[model samples]
Target: MRIYPIETGNFKLDGGAMFGVVPKVIWQRTNPADVNNLIDIAARCLLLEDGNRLILIDSGLGNKQSDKFFGYYYRWGDHTLDGSLAKLGFHRDDITDVFMTHLHFDHCGGSIQWNKDRTGYEPAFKNAAFWTNENHWQWATHPNAREKASFLKENLLPMQESGQLRFIQRGDTSFLEKSELGFDILFVDGHSEKQMIPHIRYKGKTLVFMADLIPTVGHIPLPYVMGYDTRPLLTLAEKELFLNTAVQNEFYLLFEHDAHNELCTLQHTAKGVRLKNTHNFDEIFS
Candidate 1:
């Protein structure tokens, strides 16, 4: 089996919002912000290649939102999902599975796109099955007011409408062993209800996809949580447990939103679980 980091696109988000309750004086040392108070963010997806299946972990924000809508985010990049796929000699059609870590717009927006002639929406990966758990599907569809804006309808619905949407069978435990998509899943509810973090076994190493749970290396600290989260206290507990487990298992974390630091390892420090090392995707897997 092989894995590749698919950099779909890059955008900027308010640093204050990204680092919740943390002072700019502290977070700026790790994730420095611009004069506009925005920091660079990447919609870095992951692709898994094993025999006949080409599974994409998450699809970044697509090019379907209105210009006015996008202007708010300040997206600045030359990277396109198609170009990234082409570099690896693959196409959207080649993806057999589009496994979503969650249904947030920035995470799953690329899964749907406008049809020809600017008609209604359609699945971007026409041949792939869109994956999300039953709990998340319901939460996103009938979103609470706090997360409603992030859970855009256009980014969703198409997969379900196309009859290609699928859900992983999750038990009551926080972790599910051997999910249908050929990986273990950790269900954390702090970021969003039942956010599935994939534990992929590749090349004698376990890579954990740090979706919103630990978006960037800056978030390695237990207290550095995102302001967007619904339950910060729950996040504090979940993050502490996950970080400790990650350090114990020597897991390589794959950051979905971190533009500078793609992958990192953790070690026990005097303070707590801290970053041990950072690596390029190819430095290890290649």
Candidate 2:
């Protein structure tokens, strides 16, 4: 199976929100903030060419949102989801499955688009089956007050309305050994309800799509939880277990929100699990 990194776009977010209670004096060492106190973020998605099934994980924020709405995020960069796909000699119509880690605007917003005449919304990947766990589907559709802003209806309903929405039947456990997409999934709840972290076995290595569980190398320290997480305490425990397991298993973590670092591996450190090495996708895969 061949896998490709699809860079959707780049944007800046408040460093304080990204690092939660972690002091700026500390997080700044790893993720330095700009003069505006915002740090760079990338919507890096993953594409897998496994046989005939061209699967994409985490579509980045699409361009359908109004300028006013996008101004809040302070977008930057020339990369785009469409351009990235074209670079790989593929297109949105070529995607057979779209595996969403969660329904946050920045993560799944690219799944829908404004139809002709802008009268209504439609599935961005018309031929692709939008995949998400049933539990998360419900949670996202009926979002709570704290998360309501992140779960936009324009980013969701269209998938279901297009009758292309599919759910991975999960057992009563935090980890699913195999999903319908032929990859393992680690369910995390601290960030959001039932956030699915994909563990793809490829090229004799396990490349894990870190998603919101461990967004960046800066977030590896466990206590550096994002303020956006609903259950910070649960996040601490989940991160501890996942980080330890990642080090023991020697998994390669692919970051979705980290603008600079592409991938990293962890090791048991004096201060618990810490980054062992950083690698460019082609550098290690080559």
Alpha-carbon RMSD of each model:
2.4, 2.4
**Residues 1-286 of candidate 1: C-alpha lDDT, one tens digit per residue:** 6789999999999999999999999999999999999999999999988778888999999999999989999998788899999999999999999999999999999999999978799999999889899989999999999999999999888889999998887853322224333478899999999999988877788899999999999999999999999898999999999999999999999999999999999999999999999999888778
TM match of model 1 to true structure: 0.96
Residue 189 local lDDT, model 2: 97
**What are the models' TM-scores?**
0.96, 0.96
> CA lDDT, every prediction?
0.91, 0.91
Candidate 2 residue pairs in clash (backbone atoms < 3 Å): none
Q: How accurate is candidate 2 locally (lDDT)?
A: 0.91
What candidate 1 gets wrong by more than 4 Å, as runs, is: 171-182
Please give the lDDT score at residue 179 for candidate 1: 33
**Tens digit per residue, CA lDDT, model 2, 1-286:** 6889999999999999999999999999999999999999999999988767888999999999999999999999999999999998998999998999999999999999999999999999988999999999899999999999999998999998899998887753322224333478888999999999988777778899999998888999979999999999999999999998998889999999999999999999788999999999998775
